[model samples]
Target: MRALVLRHDHASQPGLVGDRLIERGYDLTTLTVVPEERFHSPDVTFAFPSAAEWDLVVSLGAPWSVYDEETIGTWIAGELALLREARDLGVPVLGICFGAQALATAFGGSVEPAPFPELGWTDVQSDIPDLVSSGPWFQWHYDRCVLPPGAVEIARNVAGLQAFVAGRSLGVQFHPEITAPVLRAWLDLDGGTLCARLGIDPDELVSRTLAERPQALARTAELVDAFLDRIALPVG
Candidate 1:
C-alpha cells in the first residue's frame, strides 16, 4: 500500500506514525510544505497532489493556524481542496493538530483560538477506547477544531473537541507522532519562548516525552491499526 504523509513544517517529522506505517507495508512519500529556510515567512505557493494516487493520507501538525490565511494564504486553500477531494474519493485521512483544523474547515467546520492552549501531555475522554483511547497524548496547539457536519466526535476534554470521525477520515487535536527529537526541533524554533510564556519548562517536557516513549509508541501503533482495520478497510 502507499501512504502520502504531509509534513507541514521542517520540524514536524512523521515520527512513530511513519514508522508504524512502514512496518504495516506502506511505501511513504512525505511532502514537506515549508522548508527550514522559509520557516520564518511560511507563505509559499505549493501545488498539492491529487488524492486519488495514494491509498492513505496522513496530515501532520503545524505551528500555524488554518484560519490565518494572511500567513498561509498561498497554500492553505489548495490543501483544503486536496482534503475535500480525498474525502470525496474515500481516501482515509489521519489529521493531527493543525491538519485536523484543516480537515474540519474543509468539511464545513471552523478553526478558532482555544480558550487556552494545551501544551503538554494530557488525557482525554474517549468514547471508543478500542480505537481512540483516553490517553496522555502530547499537545502543542493554540487553536481548537469545531467538528464538521456529520462528524462523530470520538474524544474530547476541557480544551474542546479532541478527536472526531467523518466518513473514512479521523482528525485528532493532539499529536500522536510527537517524539523527544521532534519536541526539541520545535523548541529550537520560537517554541521555547512560547513554552516559557505558557509556564511550561521545555526541558521537563522533553524529559517526559523521552520517558513516555514506549507507551506512546504502543498507543500510536494501536491507533494506526484501528484506523486501518476499522475505518480504512472494507468489511468482509
Candidate 2:
C-alpha cells in the first residue's frame, strides 16, 4: 500500500509511525511543507496533492497553529481542503498535533489557543482503550481542537480533547512519532528558548525521550495497529 506522510516543517519527521507503516507494507511519500531555509518566513507556496492517490494519509505535527493564517496562509487553506476531500472520499487520515487541529477545522470544527500549552509527556483518559490508549504520550502544542460535528472524542486529559475520530480518520493531539533526534531538532529550532521560558529543561527532556524510546516505539506500533485494524482498513 501507499502512504502519504505530510511533514509540516523541516523538523517534524514521520519517525516511529512511518517505521511501523513501512513494516505493515506501505511505501511512504513524505512531503515537507516548510524547508529549513524558509523557517523564518514560513509563508511559502505549497500545493497539497489529492488524497485519492494514496492508500493512507498521515499528517504530522507543526509548530504553528491552524487558525494562524498570517504565518501559514500560503498553504493552510489548500491543506484543509485536501483533508476535507479525504474525509469526503473515505480516505483514512492519521492526524497528529497541528495536523489534528487542521483535521478538526476541515471537518467543521475550530482551533483555538489552549488555556495553557502542553509541552511534555502527558497521560490521557481514553474512552476506547482498544483504539486510543491512555498513557504518557509526548505532547508539544499550544492549541486545542473543538471537535467537529459527527466526531467522537475517544480520549482527553486536563488540557482538553486528546483524540477524536470522524469517519475513517483519527486525530490525536499528542505526537506518537516523536523521537529523541526529532525532539533535538525541534529544540535546535528555537524550541530550546521556548522550553527555557516554560521552565522545562531541554537536555532533561531529550534524555527522558531517549529513556522512553523503547516503550514509545511499542506504544506507537500498538496505536497504529489499532488504527489500521479498527478504523482505517474497515472502510479503506
Candidate closest to the true structure, highest lDDT? 1
Error of 2 at 194 (Å): 0.5
- Per-residue lDDT for 171 in model 1? 94
lDDT of 1 by residue, 32-134 (tens): 9988888989999888999999999999999999988898766999899999999988898999999899999999999989989999999999999888888
Write down the worst ten-residue block by lDDT for model 2: 227-236
Q: What is the C-alpha lDDT of each candidate?
A: 0.92, 0.92
TM-score of every model versus the real structure: 0.98, 0.98
Candidate 2 per-residue C-alpha lDDT over 1-236 given as tens digits, one digit per residue, 9 for 90 to 100: 99999998999999999999999999999999999998878899999999999889999999898988898775999999999889877789999999999999999999988989899898899999767778779999989999999999999998899999988899999999999999999999989989999999999999889999998888899999999988886552
Regions more than 4 Å wrong, model 1: none
Off by over 4 Å in 2: none
